[model samples]
Target: MSNDLFINLFVQITNMKQSFLAIVVMTSLVIVSCKKSATTNTNPQYKALTEAVYASGNIFPKNEYKLTANADGFLLKQIAFEGDIVSKNQMLFQLESATQDARLEAANNIFRQSEANFSDNSPILDELESQLRNARTKLANDSINYQRYKELYERNATTRIDYERAELAYQTSKNDVSARRKAWLRTKNQLYVDLQNSKSNFRVNAREDDNYRIKSFMDGKLYEVYKKQGELVRRGEAIALIGDANEVYAQLAIDESDFVKVKVGQEVLIKIDVYKDKVFKARVSKLYPKLNKADQTFRIDAEFTDEQPNAYYGMTIEANIIISQNPRVLTIPKNYLVGSDSVWIEENGDKKKIKIIKGVENLDMVEVKTGLTEKSVLVLGN
Candidate 1:
């Protein structure tokens, strides 16, 4: 080959090699740019956002109460068992009552005797009444005789001594009648007072006897029975646990930091272990004012607004109380935020950090209230 032709071929090969190298560099730059975009850049968009407070608690029946014994004795009978439905004032237990029975019997006997003594046919009162009657008869006869003797003495037909004696007899009879009547009244009053006192004492004894029985305070279901028949029970010892049969509520414990955000009538979303993956809707019904120092939490009660799960006492639950929500708002990925209230945005083909006004936020997304629009492109921070 000629030297000129060989030189021309070499030049052509060198130019092609340069062109291929340029193409490879451009391809690598494009790939790197795409990767950077995917990892660090996002755009604000309109989306629904919810802000909620997480809480954990258990299911409890309404008006839950512990039934306690009011008297100390051996349990003679247990009329209600666990899981039994009971009505108000229904007897749940009966304690041994021999001592109370004996006392009540004695009181009843005394009451009856006193009642009889207060009656008009009572022997003591009847005797006093008979004495009063006899004294009245004697007074009447002596009065007539005294009046006759006085007239005779005035007309000089009877001696003054006879008239004075007759007057003395009449005065004595009147005094006797007064004494007898006083005695009758005194005895009747004493008997009446005794009857009243005895009746009052009998009633007290009867009430003490009634204490041997343990009765229900309200209509409810018995959740637990602490004592069995033949067990010894003391006054004020828990006998059973009872609560309203048809109503149940969630008792949630909110952290002290989140308690300020909680209020009555707020919507709550609940997840119970028994009903896995199913969410139940409820509303906050109550908020306890006192803080639980042991756990540094406040108690909240929530009632189901929709269908509730079949729940037992102390069933574990997880709840999210909805603090606020935005159905449509400009939002960005949470990690894309730069600092407390700022985000990184792509501006004029360069990365720019800008402050943003925030609204509601959750774990993954944040509602951007101002300083960002749907057209804004957010960049993730390193």
Candidate 2:
């Protein structure tokens, strides 16, 4: 085409291009203005703030303990069941005691025999008494005969040799009586000792037999029964779980980092898995000094301050222990903070970073102690 026509075409194309560039620039400006307007800004406001430490634990009955058997045997009878209330020293189980029973019978038989031997009517004692009586009679006769021989010797009514022979016979009879009496006394003393030993043996066997009947250690409810009737039970084996039925407490594991902040009587907010929608209030009741090395945590116990939920043993729970709180303080959303100790504030349409003194802080908010006021506008950091 002609030079002028070509030039006209080029100029039209150039003007069209310039018009498109102008529209794009205007669109960019509008987008930029929108984004600036969309930037979030907040002001410090007076609000209640709480600082807490997170913990996890379980619910446990108070004074819980395992009931274990003291003697090995087959469980013959289960006298108590789960949920049964038992008194201290009440029999809860009866173990099979065939061997013990046999031993007890033997002990009783020996004890009865020993009793017969010790009684006044005992055959052994009666024989010893008869022997003693015979000895005494012989001694009395020998004394009379010796006195008669002495009178005969003094009156010269009998020969000296005859008197001497009579004296010798009297002395010999006296010696025989003394030996018989001594033997009787020794036999009687031996019988008495044997009876005492048998009585002691019977008592020991009786006490051992009683161990087959397991009894409760406290007045509480039975939470679990580990063994059923006819189950074999070994000594020191746990047979049941027992604890206070009406009272329960939270056993918490606090992290070592947060352990120092926990103390007795601190308020706790607990959320149990069973009661998902409800929050229970409690106070720290105990703090264990020993650290659990396996998990690097310390044990803490808390008691409910309000109505407790229907909780069972070992129910998992999450808790927040309130360390400190401020009823009303100047606070800002935690996202607005730039770093550990500074925040971005909007000043005269410009963003400025300023240092702040932070107090109590939670996951969502931070209490501003000395940096921003209620009127100060805070800018969320990038």
Candidate 3:
């Protein structure tokens, strides 16, 4: 009986030891879980917040082009300075056309040389008159001789050979007059050819000279003058820069990370670095499809909808591209999200549990997609 009581006591002690071990294990598990939950709720403010992407870039107009000169010409004059407003067809710069003028003159001289070949028939008229007078004198002499010979032959006072001789003399005189007239006309015709050539040269020279006057083709502000006075410029060289003042745009580069999020026609906020406190509203007019190799970024152009005084190109403007918006989404402070895919939520007092989600987690808030509801109060930071 005594041995049986001892065995029963030993069994009771074993049961108590197991019970104590179980309690300790349970307590340790509770403590570990509580600590984890508390750690996740560090950022209490962002627990109930919505999530979205954010990006920033520069602002610029969609239509931007660097104006280069078509030819190297001396920058003779500039109508306006870099910031001066100008109209369409307004002259940006007056490249000294002296060189072109000289070229045109040279071309004209060449043409004139060709035209100087022109000679008029009238200029040979005096020679024709002299030839005509000589021909008339020969004809008269021949007629007299022919008449005398004819009279003598008719009277049988001359031989047949004499009559034939008189006839030949008259015919030779007539032929000489005809030859002289023909030669005179030939000389006049040659002069006409020379005159035609001279006129052609003039036309060619006129055409070459007119190309020197360069005109402005677009309305804008004179942004720059590349060539200066007396500066010899070559053909097809850049001389001036112009940009539209009325229709201004913001030009900026966006990072590669934010490239996919930006789209044309998205509204963006612009803050001009030069001008403080003033915020400008702009719309993305174009997004460059190709990435910039140098910066590993894409170019985005924005048109300023908000009119600002004294706007100009190359003005650095901070741009905020709106990715997405949620009117009233649930949120929690970002610091509260401490777990690998979850956050801690306070149930009553210090008691906390894990909340899980699969959505955007911004710098300030964690978007809850699942395992959590707007009904629960999340602990952000202490």
Candidate 4:
């Protein structure tokens, strides 16, 4: 076609292209501005929640006790071994007393022999007394006869031989009397010595009988066996450990910081791993004074209100110690708190920061002492 017509058509097409570009740019800018304005009107939302300190620990019995021997010693025959149920007077152990047994038997035998001898044979004292009486009677009779002979000799009615005989008879009678006296003295001395010896032997026998065997002091369920037969044990050394299975308690170890807050007689809520969702009521019975060196924790003892069957020691427990019981306090979710207990608040459609004073809290909810009212909306990131 013509040159003028071709040039006009090219110019017209270029102008039209420029106008369309301008319109597209203006439309995009309006949409962008609209989105930016919409975003500025809305504040960042946070999810607000109030929660108490929710920590976890395992369950322990309060009445459980660990038994230990005060002195070191070898084990002997255990009358009651581990897990043996025993009565109060039941035997638990027999310590090494072979020596005591031997000694006692010897002592008892000696005593029995002495008793038999004392009963069967007449006492030396009695025999000596009888002999003395007989000697006295004989001496009296001899004196009478000797006196008569001496008198006859003195009167010169008898020969010299008769006088000599009379003198000899008198002297013989005197000597016999002296010999009887000496015999009595010897017998009396022997009786005194024998009596003293008998008493001493009896004491040795009594000691031997008592020391022959070791015995139990109290009736309990035997949970530990510390000794075996024929093991040498020192005096006062423990042979085994016993526990009362009839009653058991739970024990909980708490941090040193929480130690001050926990007090005796406080009620605690206990949950066991084995007993899920089951709440057991417990009363604080004891609070230990000394801290565990390794764990830096102190223990608290609590007894179950209801009789818990099959309660064992060292089972894991989670406890919630109710320090305060402020029910129905203004509370919120704990997640909203920022730094050092700070929360984000919305004011006039702008993000505003506020400090909140929190009180007793658990895992989910916290008691809000002071902060925004209940109607205040908390924006959680959507």
TM-score of each: 0.83, 0.82, 0.60, 0.62
Q: Tens digit of lDDT per residue, candidate 3, span 176-237?
A: 99888888778667666655665676666555443344455666666676766667767677
Q: What lDDT does candidate 2 reach at residue 255?
A: 73
Provide the lowest-lDDT 10-residue window in model 3: 20-29
Q: For candidate 2, write residues 1-382 as lDDT tens digits.
A: 2333223222222333212110011101222233443449867777655556667789988889998888899999999999888999999999999999999999999989989988889998788788778877877887788789889889998888888877887888788878877887887788889889888999999988888998888888898999989899999999999998778999988778888888899988777767645667899999999989988888999999988966377898777677775667776666677779998888998988999998876434567899789899877776
TM-score of candidate 3 on Cα atoms, chains taken together:
0.60
Q: Where does candidate 2 have its weakest 10-residue lDDT segment?
A: 20-29
Q: Local distance difference test, per candidate?
A: 0.78, 0.77, 0.57, 0.55
Any runs in candidate 3 off by more than 4 Å, and if so which? 1-80, 87-100, 109-214, 306-309, 347-355, 358-362, 380-382
Show the lowest summed lDDT stretch of 10 residues, model 4: 20-29
Per-residue accuracy of model 1 over 30-84 as CA lDDT, tens digit each: 2223343455667776765556676778998889999898889999998989888
Once all C-alphas are superposed, what RMSD does model 3 give against the true structure? 19.2
In candidate 1, the residue pairs with backbone N, CA or C atoms under 3 Å apart (3 or more residues apart, or in different chains) clash, namely none
By lDDT, who's the top model here?
1
List per-candidate RMSD values in Å: 17.4, 17.9, 19.2, 21.9
- How much lDDT does candidate 3 score? 0.57
